[model samples]
Target: MAQALAAAGARVLVVEPNAPHRLPGLLGAAAPPPEGQGQVAPGIWGLFLDPEIAMAAYLRSQVRVRAIAERMVRSKIYQRFVAAAPGLKELIVLGKVMMVYRGRHQVAGVGGFDQVILDAPATGHGVQLLRVPRLTLDTFGESPLTREARRVQEMLQAESTFVDVVTLAEEMPVNEALELEKTTRDLLDFQVGSLIVNGLCPPIGEAAAAWDPGELRADPRIAGAHYAATWCDARRRMQQQHLRRARAATRAPLECLPFVFSADEREVVAHLAAQLRATGASRREAC
Candidate 1:
């Protein structure tokens, strides 16, 4: 989503809280070549500031980083991405991204930009991070951290952004997706913007088209029409079941990322932008 937002002409500030390369390739090659690369794409600025400070400045500095990162990414365009990605602007994101900044849910940083897409971690950890701002606000009573926290919270609650959550599209992911939503409502008390079901599906509809209905209950002109139909039906039903659950489970809109059985991640981000455009999300947000 960082790539997607950046492509749409937003100054992106990627906050990274995880240990550098603790889990390499998580960000993938979704990065532009080193400065030597061709004219890099627009609307992205990643700064991987480590939360543990293994790579970041420090405990105090990390707080500053969150506000700065948020301020950098708030684009007013109110649109979804629609362009070729430039990969990473630099090797670093803003800060320890893998960690969520608690009580800092309302991001006032990355100010002036229209949107702020956090590559935040899961609910268990992420929720805890988001609550920090609120906690500090209650305890600190109008300190600088509290000010930043409220801003971050507002952004997260912004109609345009809901501490939007991103997780793999699987049983655990889906369950986490819900838990994230509920936790936000009950604990942080914010509504998440959308649930992105990433890399989902085995292409039931297309596979069904491959089989011949008439060939079924016959001498089998094909490999096995009956079996194919059953498989396709089951798969389609499963896909629908997920969709139904998404609709039924939470109030947040569910977005599907077509099963990329074998498509480049770069292509996936591009396609995602296109799909969002077609759905008028970009335009609607603009309004």
Candidate 2:
């Protein structure tokens, strides 16, 4: 999706907070050869936000001293204290995202990305991350931390910020997607912009139903083809069922990403991006 948006002439930055290795592994040969943050494609760039690195950058911005920021972030006591504090880590992560969202970071003289995409934590932790600012404000009154948190909260709640929910076309994941949508609205008052149902098998049931598989049983090759088609048709039907349930569960727009048969993650992302673009629902401003 990032690639598609970037291809459409939007400056895009993908921030991976969950697993740094995941995005790099996906971009594969398309990823820039150099170390640290680099462009994944012409208009799309990737960033891996290590907690310590994010802390150092943030502290440097606050203190205006790189050496002091480095010392503070490297301190064992500071690390332990940050880990011990509830929502502190989540707050910091969100704060870093807000920085990028608002073009407040200067790394090697490159800053102000037009669009910042955060591959944030899973549903539960993501909810917690969004709630941290309000929680801190309520608990700590007024302080530098809470002040920063408030800024992040405002950005998150802004109309320009959108929460996209992605899930598999299955029972459990669909249910979870519904729950996540509700939680985002109820807890953070953020409406889910869309529900992306990934890995949908092609619907071949109509063609399968018109064919007679028994006639091909005598030929192994034909029989194998028939069997594969039958299996795919069944899976597609199942997915359609789940997709219907998902649509009924939410009022938000829903999109299905067809299953791609490729070992390359870059190909998969490209396929999904194409699907996203075709939907004619790509919100350039909110992305």
Candidate 3:
């Protein structure tokens, strides 16, 4: 999605929070500065946010004493405080993200990234991350943290904010996706732009999908081939069932990405991006 948006002329920023960052490896681009943005593609930039680095930066921005920012972040007491706080780490990380988002808005088409795509953690951690702003606002009185949280919350709940929920056509992933969609609507009140069902098998005809390799299993020569076909057909059937379930479960647009058979990660991304573009999914957002 980041590359696709960049292709459409939007300057994109991908936030890599998880380390040994996967974005750098997937894009086959050099890792960006730990605290700064670097070009990943023509218009795409990457920002890998080390938690400690983000925390130190956040502290520096908040504290009047610039000299003590680094010292404070490195202190054991600060670490203990962070541990004690429920969503402090997530909030600090989001603080940097909102800084980028705000910076983009400030300079709309002039410079900097136009879109910020956060490569946040899986559903559980992601929910926690998204919940930090509300949590902060609820837990504290008026303070710098609360002020920052307000901005983050505003950005998150903004109509332009699109939470693209990616899932596989399987029970567990579908369940997680449904849970996320429900939470986003009912609890967080965020817009779920799309429900992306990924890695779907190519459609087989009705006869083929229902075909059985009953007699072919006895033949040695074509047994493996038939078995493979049968397995793929079974998978397609299962995928269809889950797809129906997912469609029935959410009103959000459900998009599907076919399973690509390739060792090249770039090929996979390019293929998926093309699929997304073909489906007219060109809307820009802080995904």
Candidate 4:
């Protein structure tokens, strides 16, 4: 999706908050030159959001005191404090995200980004992350950080910000997605923009069913092929059943992404992006 948006001429920055899923190491291995931000593909850039780096960068941007910010970041006191704080780290991570979303960065220049996609934490952690700012405001009253937290909270609740939930067409995940949607709406009052049902199997059940298995079973060469088709058809039917249940559960715009048979991550992203564009979910203009 980020790739497609970038391809469409949007200034795309993919933010990976989860340390493990960060692309820098993978991209560096593929193409040398280690950096905070690297071009993962044509027009698409990826940034690994190390909390300390983000906090330092954020401080430098706000205070215009790079040396002080750098020193503060390296200080054991600051590190321990940040580590001990319940949601301070998450808040800083999101602050960096808001900065990017607003197109404000000390090193990257002061132009706005057309699109900023966050590979946010899983549903439960994500909800807590979103709630931190509000919680901070309630607890801390009106400090600088709390003020910034309020701003982040406002941005989150703003009409421009849209949250899209991606889930597999399975009972557990679908139920979880629905719970997440309801919980987000109840707590944050943020309605999900869309429910993306991923890895949907193609409708091959009818075609497989129509084939005369008896004729193919007699031929040893095609027997395996027939069995594989039948298995695939069963999977497809199961997927369709889950799809129906997902649709019935929510009134939000639902989009189904077909399972892409590709080993390459780029190919999968490109395929999903195309599907998003086709569904009119890829809005070119930045909010």
Minimal lDDT window, size 10, model 4: 24-33
lDDT of each: 0.50, 0.75, 0.78, 0.73
For model 1, residues 1-287, the per-residue Cα lDDT tens digits are 55566556665545444534211133344443332111124554444334323322322354567865344344332112111111111111221222222322222233344443455556776766676556545655565445655655564564554666555545666777888888887778776666666655555556655556774456664546557766656666666666667657866666666555445655666676666645454322210
Residue 196's lDDT within candidate 3 is: 88
lDDT of 2 by residue, 1-287 (tens): 67777767787888776544477667554443354576766777777667656666667778877788778888888888777767776677788778777778643346767777878677787777778888878877678889898998898888888788888888898998999988888778976777878898876555865599786689999887788888888888888898889888876777778899888777898888877777755533211
Clashes of 2: 0
After superposing candidate 1 on the true structure, give the runs of residues whose Cα lies further than 4 Å from its correct spot. 20-40, 54-112, 137-160, 167-172, 202-233, 282-287
RMSD of 3: 3.7
lDDT tens readout by residue for model 4, 166-191? 89988899999888887777778775
Q: Model 1 misses residue 14 by how many Å?
A: 3.1
Clash statistics: count for each candidate: 55, 0, 0, 0
**Best-fitting candidate, measured by lDDT?**
3
| Candidate 2 to native Cα RMSD, angstroms | 3.2
Candidate 3, residues 233-253: lDDT per residue as tens digits?
888889889988998887687
Cα lDDT of candidate 1 equals: 0.50
Residue pairs that clash (backbone atoms under 3 angstroms), model 3: none
Residue 268 of model 1 has an lDDT of 61
